[model samples]
Target: MNILKTTALVALMGSIAIPAMAEQRVLKLFTDASDPAPKAAFEQLVKGFEAENPDVKVEVNTFDHEGYKTAIRNFLTADSPDLANWYAGNRMAPFVNAGQFTDVSDVWEENGLKDSLGSALKSMTIDGKQWGVPYTYYQWGIYYNKDVYKKAGVEVPKTWDEFISNCKKFQEMGVDCLTTGTKALWPAAGIFDYLDLRTNGYDFHMKLTSGEIPWTDDRVKAVFAEWKKVLPYTTKNVAAIDWQDAVSNIVQGKAANYVMGNFAVATFKDGGMTNDTLGFMDFPTINPDIPRAEEAPTDTIHIPAGAKNKADAKKFLAYVAKADVQTKMNEELGQLPINKNSSVGDDPYLQAGFKILSTADGGIAQFFDRDAPAQMAKAGMEGFQEFMAYPDHLDAILERLEKVRQRVYKN
Candidate 1:
């Protein structure tokens, strides 16, 4: 009888002890911040979070950007992470609909995130339910080598005519005017999107993404025409190389300019150039009639519904939302902080990007990949790569993209 009683007591005590003691939960985080500079910044922030909460452990499992997308889809369907990095806009809609992510509306309100994140970015929150918190954002624009420009004696182009003239000057200097890679399709898609923005303005970009306009719209054709005008200035090998390799062409002085996101700053620095050696500018206006616009979107962090430590994850999310944390993130990573109150430093390259992002006449539109559904964006971008290779097939590319748009958006 005593043995039985003791055994019951022991089991009860074990249960109570386990609840009282420190519990560790592994947080699987999938992110595209794979580069050393951003990785170091994330580690530093995670360390701070770990220090504050001794009982909680965050295990960040990062993958390459493309790999993360595939892995996240697999993981979310089964064995999803406690937290992860995802894009805002239509990108999150499917996951949210499937209940893969937690609805943190209350947490968002309690943390004052609605007030913290700007109105332009508030679209990230869907149907009055907050989905994620954005950490950082960088403007996409033209990055030019000042040395190359100086040698060609050409100023940064502001208008379509000026831009073409500058390209001629660079060609005369025996240099490729634009350094881009269609091997990945994104760089080429970016050029296309920026051209569309410069042609039809931001509203049209949104309408097109939302399926309010067809892929074969004349405005889109006009944008493609502008792209054709500039294509001769692009490296002949753009079809054969990736964005990184194309960027390498610029870094090696084989090309004069690269139109890319500010994230490429790290790659450029790695290739050895200071702010004095580099110049940044908005995509020159293709339509003199249209107003200037901006394409800036936040990189969001969200807690998956299956997170083992929801409370702890929320705490970490809140920690990153602090302005000081944002400043540290931006300063170290050289990207713009999502916190509007935070001031980006005096780097000329960053300043130029900021000028483009801050002073735009319209709301910031997320990148093409983020603004549109991922599957659709993928198909569209691939078609863009094909079009870059054979501009005459623009009609076929648009037809395929229209099919993808119909399938993805169902309109």
Candidate 2:
């Protein structure tokens, strides 16, 4: 009987100890960094975070870029993760207003992030409170094929007139001057945003996007007029293709230039184009009187208000906000780190982007879709896509978009 009692006690102790051993402090992270490089960088970050905090386990759930856009809305409200990757600016505003995202001001103060994040802090802040921390951002500009430019004997344009002239020259050489994919719609909005920023200035662009200004306003019309000048030079049937397909045209030398964010540089490199063969230039000066503002969309990470592990999520946020962490992750991402002290390395494209954005006197706009409400942004980008395919429908497009703006903003 004594031997049997001892055996039973040992079995009970084993069962109890196993549950204790398996109970780890889990930090659930949902990320949309599906690209190989960014996915790897995130994994590396999680590894480091786990190593530093041995008692905590981080469970990361990654989704494809497009799918995550839809999935985040569902998961954020239903089964909230400890952290999730998202965009700053207006894209984050809804979540902030809904009280879905946690206010990470404490993390910022604890880590002295204001000094580290610099200008990027503006995009992450909503109503005097910081919603999230931006880790990386890249500039949008004209990316051209040097070989194609050489074939056409046209130099990079510096002014608006020069840009138009160069497009004419490329046409004369029997080469398409510009190419873009509007199938996803957002690419067209990017072009519209740049033109608006160049022609009407950043403040006006913000007002227009935020529904403070009507889409049918003359300032908005002027932006479309400027865009019209370049449409003739763009690839035909752009609505049928996506951004990657348009990028292939530039890579294959079917087109001379593309207006895109710096992230597209990776696509170019993968298409077998060398850095020396590709050239990066700022979007030419349209309104030289307007101080140069840039479309520098920042990607951010946030702790959800419904997070099960707020303390651990804050720890991860603080870890990511560090300069060293930003540097490493951006090195993997091949993009500019938001931390002012982080190195951008020897990538010429990144260096140029860094210089342009860091020196932008007029500040930055977080791309059209990011800076505008989702409902309005969707209709606006679709209108842009329609306008690209049928410029004559500009008025109709603007009217339709204006209706969406009114409904969405209740203006």
Candidate 3:
């Protein structure tokens, strides 16, 4: 009888320990940081998280930036990860609407993230509920060739008339006034977003993206009209080349400027262009009456609705939301940390971007594709590219885009 009792006790103890062990099992993470710097930063973040939670193991599955975009839609529904990386704003809207992303507002409230994250919180929130925590974001502006600008004797133009005049002068100096690649489509959308933001203001831009305003409206057409005035100075055959190829025109001194995000700095450096040769400037003012809104697309992380380990996923989100983690990760990736308390380091370009975004009284735009629905973004970018390639067809493009907008938001 004594032997049998002892064996029963041992079995009970084993059963109790198994449950405890299983509680600390793997937390799968799906990420898209194919670039070396961002990938390294992500690895360090995971390493830190693992060290902090010794009981939990993080299984990271990384994909190339482009491949991950398509792969995420499938995985989020079929084999969901405990955590995933994605953009804020309209980019997150589809997943939120589909109920694939967890409502992380509780996490934000519990962790005091609302105060810590500041304005960035607004980008991740939908229907008055927060969806994710933003890790990093960068500013968009006119990155110009300093040498080309100096040779043309043109200072950074701050008004519409001066901007057009400077473009003419640059063309007279035997260089195209601007170089942009619309082959990828989104670059052209960036230009359009800025024009709309500067012309009508942030409220109008947001409404337009949300399908509250028609693409063929007079306000939107006015934006395209302004854009047409600058098109004469942009590179010829823009639709035939990708953004990187277009950057070559600026690097080789064949073009004066490129309106792009801060992420392009690394590519310029790799092409033998340095900060001394390359300069950053805000897009020239179109309407002095309209407040100056900056384009600052934010990237975020979230827990999937089907996450197997909500407890552990919350822990990971909390870990990354801290200012220290944001600072370290963005520093490694050469991007600005979204946390207001985080340091931008001594990099001048980063400092400039941070200053431009943080001080924008007019507020921030999450960029065109990010601020609009996925289907609307797709049709909008195509229309933007078409308008840039053939400005004469502006009315036709707007009408077609209006049809897409109507269909996409048809409730």
Q: Write the residue-wise lDDT of candidate 2 on 166-235 in tens digits.
A: 8898898777898999999988877888898899887788778778999889888998899999889989
Model 3 scores worst on lDDT over the 10 consecutive residues at 355-364
Which parts of model 3 are misplaced by more than 4 Å? 1-26, 63-67, 288-291, 361-364, 373-375
In model 1, which residue pairs have backbone atoms overlapping below 3 Å?
Answer: none
lDDT of 3 by residue, 1-411 (tens): 999999999999999999998877799999998789989999999999999998999999999999999999999989899999998877888899999999989889998987777657667778989998989889999899999988998898887678889999988888998889988899998898888988998879988998999988999999998999889998998989999998899999999889899889889888889979999988888888887777899889999999999889998998898889999999888888877777888878899887776666676779988889878999999988888878989889989999998999997
Clashing residue pairs in candidate 2 are: none
Between candidates 2 and 3, which one is better according to TM-score? 3
Per-prediction TM-score: 0.75, 0.82, 0.85
Candidate 2 wrong stretches, greater than 4 Å: 1-26, 33-36, 54-71, 74-79, 151-153, 240-245, 252-254, 266-272, 289-291, 361-363, 373-375
TM-score attained by model 3: 0.85
Tell me the lDDT of model 3 at 335. Answer: 88
Span of ten consecutive residues with least summed lDDT in model 1: 114-123
Badly placed stretches (over 4 Å) of model 1 are 1-39, 50-71, 74-82, 105-116, 119-123, 171-175, 210-212, 248-255, 266-273, 286-298, 305-315, 331-334, 343-347, 358-366, 369-375, 407-411
**By lDDT, is 1 or 3 better?**
3
How high is the CA lDDT of each candidate model? 0.78, 0.88, 0.88
Error at 117, model 2, angstroms: 1.9
